[model samples]
Target: MPREVKKRGRRQEHKERKAKTTDHHQRSTKRLKTDHTADNGNALEVSGDAGDDFIGFDIAQPEGAHELQEETQFHGLLEPQEQEYYANVNNKIVANDFESAEDRATFIEAVHRETEGKELKVASSQSCSRYLEKIIMLSTPEQLRRLFSKFLGNLSYLVQHRFGSHCCEMLFLQAAKHVEKEHNKNASTNDDLASMENLFLQAAEELEPNMGFLLTERFASHIVRVLFLILSGESLDDDIVKAMLASKKKEKLDAPASKESELPENRRAVPKSFRTSLDRLIRSGVSTLDTTYLRALATHPTGNPVLQLLIQLELSASGKIKLSDENSVFHKLLPDPELEEDSESAKFIAGLIYDPTGSHLVETLVKQMPGKQFKKLYKNVLKSRLRSMSKNDTASYVAIRILERLGKDDLAEAKELIVPGLPILVSRRRTGLIKVLIERCAIRGVDLQDVADVIRSEYTKDDIDFLSALLDFKRNGVQDKTQKKGSESEKSAKSAHKTDVHGSLLAQAILQTSDICNLVQDSLLAVDVSTLTAMCQDSASSRVVQTALSPTEFNIQFRRHFVPRFYDQIATLAQDLTGSYVSDALWSATDGLHFMKQRLARDLANNESQLRDSPFGRNVWKNWAMDIYSRRPGEWQALAKGQERDQPQGGPQQNAPTGEKQKSAIELARERHAQKKSHSTNRKRNPATGANAAISTNA
Candidate 1:
C-alpha cells in the first residue's frame, strides 16, 4: 500500500509538469493562426518565434532555353518592341478599327509615341506604314481630299523621316490620284497645284535661310520634286500671281515674271518664261537661281530630277546676258576670285564637274547655259581643270559634250588648255577624251595645225619623244619651231618606235572618226611615200599607216592616192608581215572599197598564177569577198571589172581569151617550177662530194 501511494504521488507531479509544457505551445499556435488569418498570408506563415531557418533541395530548371529565346523573336526582325508593335497593328487592322478618323488619329498617335526616340524604329515604322496604307485605301475620296491639305503641310517632315517616308510615298501617290480624279470633272489643275505650290512656297520661304539643309533632307527632297513638277507647267502664276508680292506667301509661291533687264543689278535676271512655271504666271517680276540654292542640291541623291527640271527651262533669248557686254552684272553674283584664287563661279562649276550627280548638271549646262554663263564656266573653271577632269570617266563625258558646242575661238583656247596635259593623257591612254576632242575639233572645223605642229616637234630627227620634260610647254598659244635637229640615224628610228606604238593607237582612233580623219590626213599629207613606206614596214607605225590609208574612213580621198600609187608595191608589201596588214587596211577602207577592189584585181590580172602563188598575195582576198572574183581555174581575166584592160582585145573576137597571154602565163609558171627544182637540187648536193659542190656553187 505504501509503494502504490509513492507511484501515485510521482504520477501526479508528472501530470502537473506536462500541463505546464503544453500551456505555452497552445498559445503560440493560436497566435500564428490568428496572425495568418488577419493578414491573409501576405507575410511569412512562420511565427516570429520560428525565425528564418529553411531546408535545401535540388531544383530542376526548364529545358531548351536557347530554343525558347529563338522562338520568342517574332518574324526574325530581331526586335521585341517592333514585334509587339507590328502585332498590335495587325490586331487593330483585323478589327476594322481604321474605318473612323478617331481610329486613324489613335493609330497615328500610337505611331508617334512609338517613334519618340532618335533612331528610327523600323518595326514601328512598318506598323505605321501598314496602318496608313489601310486607311488611305479604305477611306473615301472626300476623306482623302479633306486630309490632303494637312498632309501636304507635314510632307516636308514626312518625306525625310524614316517611319514617315513610306506613309509619305503612299500619300503622294494617293494625292496625285485624287488630283487626276478631280481632273475628269472640269477641274483645273491650277486649283490643286496652287494649294500644293502655296505649301511648298511657304516651306521654301520658311526654310530659305536653311535651304541647303532642306535640299539635303531625304524627305524634304520630295517636296523639291513636287515644286519642280508644278513648275513644269505653262504658267505658274496664272491663278496665284496677281496677289504675289502683296501677299508674301503667295508671292514666294509664284515665280517671278518675264521682263527685260535694263539695270546692272538686274542683268542676271531671267525673264519669267525662262524660270519655273510659277515664273511664267507673274506679269512683271524676275528671279534668278542663286549660288546658295544651287550649292545645297549639288551633291544630293534626289538631285537628278531637280537638275533635269532646271535643264528643261528655256534660256531667255530676247534679252540674254552677253559675256562681252561692258556693263554686265552677272559676274558680280560671285565674289570676284583673283587670278591665283578660284572664282566663286569657277569654284561652283568645278565642284559640279567632279560630283557624281552634279557632273550631269555640267552636261546640261553645256547644252543649255547661255554663252555668257558658259564662257565664265569654261574660262574660270573648266579650262584650268582639264587635266584632272580628262582622266575621270564621268567628267570626261561632260568634257566631250562641252567640246562639241564650242566655237572655233573657244576651241582654240581649249586647245591651249589641253596642250600642257596632252602627253599625260596620251601616256595614260585616255583614249576616250582624246578621241572626243579630236573628233569635235575636226567636225567643228577648228584648226588642227596647232596640235599637228606639236606632234611634229615631238618627233625630232634623233628621238621621237614626248616625255614629261617635253610636256611642259609655255602657254603662248604658239609652238617653238627652232629645236635643234638630230641625225635620222638607225638608233633614232629605233628610239622612235616607242612613240610609234602610241602614235599608231592615236592614229587608229583618229581614223575611226570620219569627220576628223581628213583633218589629220591633211595635216600629215606633206610626208612623202619614202617616209610612209619606211613607216608602213615597221611593226608599230604600220598600224598608223593602215588606219590612215583605210578605205572605210570617211572623206578618205586619200585612198585613191594611196592605192593607185602603191599598185606596184602591192606584191612586195603583201609578203611582209607588217606590210601585209597595211595592204589589208585597203580592203576595209569604207570610202573607196570598190576602187581598191578593182585596183587589186587589175594587179592580179597581170601576174595571174605567179601572184596567186606569192605569200603576201594570199591574204589580199577575204573569204567573204571571194565571190567578187571568178572561181574558174583557167579563165583568168585581163582586168577586174570597172578597171582599164591593160591588153588589147583579139582581132575578131573581143570576148574570147587571148592564147598568147595564156601561154605566157603557163610558160612563166613552168619556168618558176624549173627554178624551184634546180634550187632544191643544189641544196640537197652532198658537201663531201667536192666536184658536185664546186659545180653547184658555179651553177
Candidate 2:
C-alpha cells in the first residue's frame, strides 16, 4: 500500500473540540462548520459556549468535533454453508410464491429450526441481516417472544451496530402488537415464556443506562424513536415518524408487511408498566443531557427528528398534562409559556421556521403545542410572515401544518395573504398550499369564488387543458426538448409519469366543493372522446372521473352526458387495470337510466371474450354479473331493481331458478309490505262488491 491512513479515535476528537473552544474564545466572530454527511455512528458534540451565547441562531461546528466511533459488535460469524443456506431462505421468502398460507407457515417453521441458536449471529451479518428482518416480519407471537428473549442483554450494543439496528427495530415493531393482543385477552402463552408486555419492559430497562447516548447515535437514534412509539402505543404508520424513519437511505425489502404495519391507528393499548417506563425514559434523556446539548440537538441531523418525536410525545401525553411539567423536554426547549416577542424562545422559534432540519421540529410543535402558546407564537412570529413562508421551499410545509390548526377568522386572513401569490405557488409547484387553502375555505364558509377565479385565470386555456393542467398531465408540446432538466424538473417528470398522486388528490378535493365542482365537471364533459378515454386509462386521473360521475358530486345530467362518452370504449376500459375501475363507476352512474344500462350490458356482452380472457377484465365481468345477464336477462334486471323473482309481477313466494342465491331479508320485507298495501287498497275501492263476494264464499 502507498500509505495507510487511520481514522481519528474518540479521545482524539474530544481533545480537538477542547482546543477549538479555546481558539474560538480568542476570535468571537469566526464561525465553525459541522459535517452533515449521512453517518449514523456520530454523537452530537458542540464545539464551544459560542452557541449558548447566541440563543436562537444556527451554531455551526467543525468537521471532526461530532464524530463518534461506530462500534461493531462481533457476533460470531457464519460458515460458508450457513451463509449460503440463509441466503437461499431469504430468496424463498422474497419470492413469496407459496401455494397457500399453510405452506408458508410450514416453510417458516423449518427456517426457525435452522436458525434457532444463531439469531444474533444472523442479525449482525450484513448479508444475512435482511433474512432476519423477514423472519421477524413473518414470525408468530410465540416465535417473536423467543427471539426477544435471545437478544435480551445485547440490545444496547446491537442498537449501535449498523446491521443489528435494523433487526432490533423490526423486532420491537413486530412484537409491540402482541403485547396489546395478550393484554386484551387477559392471557399469555400456555408455556414457560414470559408475557410479551413484561419482555418489552425488560428490554427498555436494558437500554435505560444508554438512553442519552443513543438519542444522538446515528443508528441508535432510529431504534430509540421506535421504542418510544411502542411505549406510548402510538401508531408506527404516522406520517411524522414515517418521514423521520425514511431519512436514512436503505433498501426496502420486498417481503409482505404485517397487518399492524399496513393498518393505521391513533393509539394502541399498551400496559401500565409501559406508561411508567415511557415517563422514566423521557425523563432519562432530558435529565442526562444539559440544556446546551438538548438545544444543540434541535438542528443536529439525526437528533432533530428524535427530538421532534419526543416533544410530540411529551405534549400529547395524558391529555396534555405534561405540557407544564418543569422537567419535560418541551419545557426545556421553550421555557416561557407565553413565547413573548424578542425573547430567546421566540427567536429560536423564528429561526426554526426556515431551517431545513429545524423546520420539521417547528411543525411538530405547531401541531401539538398548547393552544395558548400557539396563539401567542402565531401572533408574535408567524402572522406577518404567512405569505413569505408559503412561498419558501422548506417552510411551505410548516405553513401547511399551521393552516390545519387556524380558526375561521385566521384562515380567512391566511386566504387573503395566500391568494395573491397563487401564481407564484403554481410556478414553484407548491400546489399543496393552494389545495389546503381551498379545503379550509370550504370548511370555514369562506368565499371559494376567489380561488375558483385564480384557477380559471391561471389555466386560461380550453377546458381540456384546464383539467390537464390541474392533473399535471404533460403533453408533447408543453415543454421544449431543449429545456434544461434540473432536479425539480426531473422530480416533476417522474411524478407525472407515475400519474402524479398529489395532482390527483388536488382534483378530488376540488370536485368535493359544490362552489367550484362544476369547474372540473364542465372540463371533464367538454373533453373529446379520445382524451376522455386517456383520462379513464390513467391510474390517477381515473379517480377524478369516478368522483365526477358520483351523484354526491355531480347531478344526473352530468352523468348522462359523461356515461355516453365511454360507451364506444367500454371494451377497452374493461381490459385495462386502471380503466377497469372507471368501467365499474359506470355501473353506478347509470343508476336510473334504463336505456343506458341496456346499452352498457349489450356492449359488455359483445366484448365477452376479451373481458373473460384478462385478469382485470375478469374482475369487471364478475362485478357486473354478466353471466346472469346472458342466461336470464329478466332476472338480472329484476335483481338489479332489488327484487329476487325472474318477473316483476311474481309474488314473494315465487323463487328464482335452482342454484340461484336466496333473497335478502330487506327484499323479502319490502315485498310483504307491498302485498299488504295492495290488499287493503282493493277492499277500500269496492266495499259492496267485497261484502257480496264474502257472502257467496260462505254459502
Candidate 1 local accuracy as lDDT? 0.47
Candidate 1 lDDT, tens digit per residue, 79-176? 67665765676566556545666666566555544543412234225454555454444444444454444554444345555555555444443343
lDDT of 2: 0.77
Candidate 2 residue-wise lDDT, 1-699, digit = tens:
587875679998888889998787666544433363234443343434423322221223222223233353476999999999989998888888889877887888889889998988898899999888998888888888888999898887788888999999888888886787799888887568878988889988877755766777767888998899899888877775787764747667667654654434567888888989988777766675556678788888878988888888777775356667778788788887778788888888889889998998999889997888889989988888889999999899999998998999999898888888888876565679888888888888888898888887777545446777777766542232113234457545534454566777778888888789888888887777876776777778889988887666347777778788888688788888888888887776776776786788789899989888989888777667678788878877875554554322321222245676655557766887999999888775544468788897787
| Per-residue error (Å), model 2, residue 202 | 1.6
Clashes of each: 14, 2
Taken over the whole model, the C-alpha lDDT of each candidate is 0.47, 0.77
Q: Which stretches of candidate 1 lie over 4 Å from their true place?
A: 1-158, 161-214, 226-230, 233-367, 376-402, 449-509, 512-699
Model 1 scores a TM of 0.35
Alpha-carbon RMSD to native, per candidate: 29.8, 10.4
